[model samples]
Target: MSFNVGLSGLNAANTALNVTGNNIANSATTGFKSSRAEFGDVYANSLFLGSAKNGVGSGVTTEQISQQFNQGTITNTGASLDMAINGNGFFMTSDNGARVYTRAGAFGTDKSGNIVDANNNQLMGYGVDTDGKVVQGVLIPLKVDTSALAPKPSDSLSETMNLNSSAVAPSVTPFDAKDTNTYNYSFSTDIYDSQGNSHSLSQYFVKDNTNQWTMYATVDGVNPHDPTSTVPYTATLNFSSAGVLGTTSVGTPTVGAGFTQAANGKFTLTDWVPAAKNAAGVMAANGSAPADGGLVMNMTATTSYNTSSAVTAKDQNGYATGSLTTLSIDGEGNMFGTYSNGKSKTIGQVVLANFANVQGLTPNGNTGWRESASSGVPVVGAPQSGTMGTLNAGALEESNVDLTAELVNLIKAQSNYQANAKTISTQSTIMQTIIQMT
Candidate 1:
């Protein structure tokens, strides 16, 4: 009995040592969780003995090994693809068709542009639609689109400007784009066409009377109506005595051949053809057209004030075709790709999976865990949503193992092993003395 007890004790201590060694060994591993070994005592008794006041234990037996799921420290790695969870959640990945969960966020792009971990497991995420909105419920492998972004034609122009109410009209008879004497002030901006080509749209403002002005516009220094003609598109501006712009009192504003002003007082340039300077210094059509809905110009914010004529703010919605420049991830796990044209779009959103019983998960190799029957179904969601955690891009979570505590456990296990060995040795000595007495 003593020999059996000693052997069991030795086995329990050895298991403890092994568990501690494993914890210490994985102290530097990413997303590693520590574990502990538990033991139970064994006893044997007869039914006739009933409840004996003093019962000797038969031996010790291994009970179970439990895992600790404490939070680990996050460290910045400066890698764009690396991610770390700030709270509770795991990154769900797919190896072939099998799904696994992990806290290790060391990821990179595979050859096909899919985001994958070191084991080539593809990271699952919610994909975006054509409008760049996240589509939930459906899970797909996240991919980075490296194709060039198509250009968008200029469809709207918003300008806020102040025209000098005290200035006199220009002395010149006809409007000339090159002659400064022909117009009081000029504003020029770059607008994109359907083919991603750039063209200059210039607006020349001439003070006609105390509260009236004549505005002339040109595309590439030529008439928008006729590219071969230098005659520019003309419009009249009427301002009230209070310096507020009123409805048109002269020639009505027109765009293209038949496009006219809407009831909202906004002018739409429907027929402005994109043009470029030829080798002979003549502006000609470059085979590009305006946006599908035409370009709407909002001049309602323009006012004739006593101040100097100046454009306070002006903006146009258009951009040239661009290539991917950089990628970034936000706290909500939204992956954004910035283009060379100074535009950013959502590529995809990363989804995290959480379980009701994290300890119930079965450990798979490569720092991943498979969902077991004991572990409840995965509660998958985007980061920062509901009880899920937020993501920290360019960072990683270190192991939860504590080396100092493991080292102390190592010493305790070693002492327990020695004490058990002494027990067996003492029992053998007793047997030897009994044999000598015989």
Candidate 2:
């Protein structure tokens, strides 16, 4: 009976040492959780069911090994795609046709633009729809849009400028872009066409009176109305005594058109005729008119004051084709992609999952776990939603294992082993003495 007890104690001690050693080995591992070995007292029955004083308790036996799911330390790695959970939930990933959950966020993208972990298991998430909204359904591998962006035609433009009131009117009658004497001040901006082609939009301002100014607009130095005629699109500006603009009158492009004009006399361009650039970098007139409507220019804030002439703000809603430049993930797990054209779009969102009995989950490899019957069904959701946690981009979670605690446990295990060995040695000595006396 002593031999059996001593052997069981040695086995239990060895198990403890293995558990502690495992924890120490993974101390520096990312997203690693520590584990503990548990044991129960053993009291096996004899072959004949003998009772009373003959009963004896056996040594300890292995009961269960549990994992500790505590929050790990966060370290910023400066990796854009690297992410960490701040509150709760695990990053749900998919293996070869198998679902896996992990806290490990060391991830990279494959050649196919799919986001994956070190083991090449694809990270699952919700993709965005055309409207940039998250599409909730069965999870799929998140793929980034790395293709070149499409161009958008100029739709609206706004400019706020202050015209000099003390300036004298230009002597030139017919406005000509090549002659600087025809206009007082000129401003230019780049606008995109239907084919993503860029064209220079120049506006020349000529003071007519104390409160009146004329603006001559041109594209690539050519009049958009008629190529044969050098006269650019014209507009008249009238200012009030307080320097605020009062009325704006644009030259009628067509004799009969359905363009809507505002009560404030703001100019509206409905149908724009496309133009091309010549070898000399001048915008040459194209014979075909663009099917898309023309560009709308707003100058409701134009002012004629005694101060120096200056343009306060200029903004246009048009951009040429661009390529993907960078990516970012928000706390809500929304993945955003930026293009060279200065436009941003939401592409995907990270998916997170949680379990009712986290302790009951089966520890799978890759710092991940598998769902088991003991662990209730997974509750899947987007990050920061419900009981799920928010995400931290550009960082990773360190292992929660404490080296000091494991070292102390190692000492205890070694001592237990030595004591059990001593017991067995004493039993051997007593048996030898009994034999010698007999």
Candidate 3:
């Protein structure tokens, strides 16, 4: 009986030492959780003896090893794909087809552009549609699309300018794009076609009278009405005595050719063919068509004031094809890809899984855990949603192990082992003494 008690004590102490050693070993591991060994006192029981008031403790037995799920310190790693959870939740990954959960966020892109961990396990997340909208309630492996962004044609152009009302008529009679004396002021802007081709649209303003002006428009230095002719498309601007623009008239050559005034008081150019200039300064079609529904030009903000003629604001909606430039992740786990065209689109959103009994999860090595019957089904959702925590991009979570505490535990376990060994040795000596007396 004494031998059995002493052996049990030794076994318990050894187990404690093993647990402490493991905790100390993983002190520097990322996302490692510390564990502790729990023990219970042992005693013999008999139905006939009932409860003995002076019953002596037999020994100690290992009961269980429990894990600590406390939050670890987050450190910035400056890697774009690295992520860290700030609170409760684990990053869900797919090892082949099996779902695994982990707190380690050291992730990178695989050969196929799929975001994966060191083990090549793909990370799971919600995907985005072509329009960059997040598709909820569906799980998919997150991948980065590196395809070039398609170009968008120009459909709208807006300009705001103040024409000098005190300016006199140009000394020249007719507008000549090559002669500055034929027009008081001129402005040019670039507009895109369906094929991403750019064309220059120039406007020349000539003061005709006290409150009237003649505007000549050209595309690539030629008439938009008849590309073969050098005569520019003409429009008359009539202003009230108060210097406010009123009813306007575009010359008959442009009334219905490609430019028309809409009921909303804006001009719409529906037939302006995209053209390019040759080396000899001749303009011709470039085989690209205008945007669908034509280009809507808003010039209602034009004011004729007694000031210097200048364009206050001008903008066009168009872009050329672009390639992916950078990737970023936000607190909500939304991944965005920025392109060289100065545009950004949603790539995917990372999803996190949380269990009701996190401690009941089965360790699957590599800092990952598998769902078990003891651990309730995973509650998966985007970060910062519901009870889940927010994500920190370009960062990682460090192990929660405390080296000082583990070292103290190591000393205690060693002392327990020595005491147990001394007990066994003393028991052997007593048996020896009994034998010598006999």
For all candidates in order, the CA lDDT equals 0.88, 0.83, 0.88
* TM-scores for every predicted model: 0.93, 0.87, 0.88
lDDT of 3: 0.88
Once fitted onto the true fold, the runs of candidate 1 whose alpha carbons sit more than 4 angstroms away are 45-53, 249-259, 275-285
User: What digit string (tens of lDDT, one per residue) describes model 2 on residues 1-438?
Assistant: 489899999999999999999999999999999999999988866566656246678888989888999899999998879999987889888898788899999888999999999989888999877788889876878988799887888878888888898888889866778888988999898887776777788889999888988887776666654444555677788889888888776666543132334535356656445355689977676554332657777888778889888899999988888899999999988899999988988989999999999999999987999899999999999888899988999999999999999999999999999999988998899999999999
- lDDT (tens digit, per residue) of candidate 3 on 1-438: 488889999999999999999999899888888898999998778565657556778898998888898999999999999999999999999999999999999999988899999989999999998788999999999999899988888889999988999999988766788999988999998887777766788989999899988788877777665777767767788888887778787777633378777733367788776456688877666678888988888887888999999999999988777899999999999999999988788999999999999989999889999999999999999999999999999999999998899999999999999999999999999999999999
Q: Which ten residues in a row have the lowest lDDT in candidate 1?
A: 249-258
Expressed as tens digits, the lDDT of each residue in 1-438 for candidate 1 is 489999999999999999999999899989888999999998886676766447889889999888888889999999989999989899999999799899999999988999999999999999999988989999999999999999999999999999999888888878788999989999898998998888898999888887779888887786677676666777788888998888752243333352456533467788876456689988666788889988888888989889999999998989999999999999999999999999999999999999999888999978899999988899999999988999999999999998899999999999999999999999999999999999
Arranged by TM-score with the best first, the candidates are: 1, 3, 2
What TM-score, to 2 decimals, does candidate 3 have?
A: 0.88
Output the TM-score of candidate 2: 0.87
Worst lDDT run of 10 residues, candidate 3, spans 256-265
